[model samples]
Target: MKIALNGRPLTDQTKAAIQALLGELARRGAEVQINDAYGQTLQEWGVMHPFTSLYTSRADLFDADFVFSIGGDGTLLETVTHVGERRLPIVGVNTGRLGFLATIKPEEIAQTLDWLENGNYSLDERVLLHVENDRDVFEGTNFGLNDFVVTKTDRSSMIVVHTWLDGEFLNSYWADGLVISTPTGSTGYCLSVGGPVVLPRTNNFIIAPISPHNLNVRPIVVNDSSRIEVRVESRSKNCLISLDSRSKVVDDSIRFTVRKEKFGAQLVKVKGDTFLETLRSKLNWGLDIRN
Candidate 1:
């Protein structure tokens, strides 16, 4: 088996767990590849080994059977960009707080590897949002596994986002910003702004306002197939646009559209894990102190 490893900067607490996982993979004769950035970090920490292949670009991940995303949910999202349209299955290891996407724990690394070797895992396909504009916004990849956000720039007052769905006028949102989230992202920024949590397979998009002037305005769900067009008018000359973790400043005159991507991200689901279970555990869904 061939595996690609990618992640953010590792902390002292996670170093030992990573070393143990790597050692076990080596003992099992599985080929391991590490992203160049992570490889450099490991080398600086005196943990780089002879068995690991280092790669700097997505082209180097062509032969990987699976990609291991270490760190938190944000790290897993970054992994999706590397996987791109190839639809490579990613196994997320949580070494950060509130890991909604990176559900696997460091203690479960060995067990998870056993399941993978024994063919006891399934793939969860997650829809991605693609951003379109007259000119390049996000260079190279314009798709995000979580959401696309439009907000006012710093020191700017609230912006007006004229939104349309499938060419039909939706509403002119007067707020700090707007969020267009995929079902997979319902638990993220959208949820913070009162968006309903839709099941991952629901094939829906959430349009949630951020600090709307009208308290009665609520988040609305739309079919994933619907095209969402947004034109921003801000007091400042520019506004901020973010696709997942990447953010950029754009002119208020720029108009952009978002739609569901043709291909989705594939997440590896090990046996005994379910989304409902994760929700209950991570969010403390049914827990009550008064009980």
Candidate 2:
């Protein structure tokens, strides 16, 4: 099988796990294509491998059986941009704090790979928000697996975001920022700001204000079919716009519209590893904390 690999710098513990995984894949005669930056990092850390090729960009990627994202959720997000519309089933190995997306364990890499080869996994397709703006930033890849965010720049006062749902006036948000979160991302920024934790397949978008001036403003859940648009009025004449981990600073003149992307991200889930189980473990749910 062919495998494409991408990752971030390794931790002291995960380094050894990566070495073992590479050796196992080589022994199994699997073809490996690694990201150039990650390959450099591995070489620096003395993790040798029999690599078929190095992928510097999305153009270097071909049809592979799987894409291994070996780091935190940010690395997985970067891998998504690399895979782009090809939408390879991604397996994320967490080596960062609070890994909301990258759930696979490093030690279980060998077993999980075997499971994948034997068709013992399922694919979870997730929604991504697409951004349209007057400025040609983001280089044509304008979708994110998480949420679309607009926040005031550092030291800037709170901004006013005039929002509309499918051309109808929604609300004028007088807040530090606004978040348009997908159900798959309900556990991310939305949850941090008192938004509801929604199931991944709900196909709904949550509009949550960040530190609103009016305390009565609450998060609103809207159907994914609706198009959401926002116009910013900032004292600094600038605001920060983010699609997942990627962000840019732009002026208020840029018209912004966010909608569900045409294609979705594909996450690989091994049998027995369910989302409910992940929540129970990751969030420490159902654990007794009483002393």
Candidate 3:
């Protein structure tokens, strides 16, 4: 089995964990192809690895079988972008807090790798949001596995986002920002802004406002197939638009539209692990205070 590894900067904190991962993969005879950035980090740290090759550009991932995302959820999100429309199955190794998305633990590395080798896993196909703008915002990598956000830049006053669903006019939101999150991302920014926890496989998009001026305005769930359009009217000359972790400041005059990408992300989940299990564990649902 061939695995492509990509992650954030390496630190002394995560060194042992990574070493164990490399040693185990080498022991199991699984081919490891690491990203250039991560490869450089490993070399700089004098961490011995068994990586067969280094891949830099996303196009270079053609020969990879599985994309292993190391670090945190942020790294996994970036890996999703790099995977693009190839639909490669991704396994995330969490080395950060919260870990709402990166579910793998360091302690379970050996067991998890064994399961991966023996084909004891399922794929969780996650919907991706594709952003369209006048001048190709985010350029080639304009899709995200999570939510799309339009927020005010810095301390700029609240922005008014005129929203439309399937070409029909929706309400104009007067708030700090707006978040159109996928069901997979319902627990992220959407949850922080009072959105409901939606099932990951649900074919819907949750439109949630960030601190809306009108208390009555509530987050709404829309069909994933529906087209979403927004025109921003902010006091500041420029506002921020983001696809998951990637954010850029653009002129408020830019009109934006969001839609489901043609191809989705495939997250590899080992058997016995379910989304409900993760959700309940992460959210601490049904836990008694006295327990």
Candidate 4:
């Protein structure tokens, strides 16, 4: 089996885990490839392996059967850029705080790999958002597994976001920002702002305001099939637009539309692991404080 590895900067703890994982893979005779940037980081840390290939671009990962994302959820999100439309299955290893997407811990690596090798895993298809704008933005890869955020820039006051669903008027949100999240992202920024936690297969999108001026304004859930159009009015000429972890400054005049992407992100899930289990562990759900 051919596997690809990608990650952000690693700490000592993560490096040790990665080393162990690589050693196990080598012993099993699996062909391994590392993202070029991550390979350089490994070399800097004096962790070199003769059996691994280093790939510099997305095309280099085309032949990979699976891509292991090491680090936090942000690292996994970055891996999406490399996978693009390839729909590669990603296994996220948690080495950072609040790893909602990167569910597997370092201690579980060996067991997880064993399951992966024996075909004891399933693919969880997570929906992605395809962003459209009047001008070129976010390069050509405009799909995101999480939410798309539009907000005011630093030093600027709260902006007004005029929203529409399927060309019908929604509302003018007077707030710090707005979040349009997929069901997969409902647990993320959407939840922080009081949005409902949606199940993965809900086929819905969440519209939540960030610090809305009106106290009565509440988050709303909409059908994923609906096309969302947004226009921003900010005192500052620019606004901040972010897709998952990537962000850029854009003119307030830029019209934006978001819809469900044609393809979804494929997440690897081994048997006995469930989303509810992750929620309980990560969010301390059902913890008995009185105990």
**Could you give candidate 4's per-residue lDDT for residues 1-291 as a string of tens digits?**
788999888788778988888887787788989998998888898775554678887876757788999999999988988898899999998988889999988999889988998999999999999999978688887989889999899755889999999999999999999999999899999999999999899899999999999989999999999999999999987899999988999999999999999989999998766888888888898889775
**Per-residue C-alpha lDDT of model 1 across residues 1-291, encoded as one tens digit per residue:** 898999888789988888887888888888888898988888787774544678887777757888999999999999999999988899999999999999999999999999998999999999999999988888878999999999998755889999999999999999999999999999999999999999999989999999999999999999999999999998887899999999999999999999999999999999777899899999998898875
10 residues in a row with least lDDT, candidate 4: 48-57
Instruction: Note each model's CA RMSD in angstroms.
Output: 1.2, 1.5, 1.2, 1.3
Clash totals for all models, in order?
A: 0, 0, 0, 0
lDDT of 4: 0.90
Highest lDDT against the true fold, candidate: 1
Return the lDDT, model 1, position 188.
Answer: 97
Q: What's the true lDDT of residue 250 in model 2? A: 91
lDDT, candidate 2, 47-73, per-residue tens: 998889999988889788899998888
In model 2, which regions exceed 4 Å deviation? Answer: 289-291
- Off by more than 4 A, model 4: 289-291
The C-alpha lDDT values of all candidates are 0.91, 0.90, 0.90, 0.90
Candidate 3 to truth, TM = 0.97
Model 2 scores a TM of 0.97
- TM-scores for every candidate against the unseen true structure: 0.97, 0.97, 0.97, 0.96
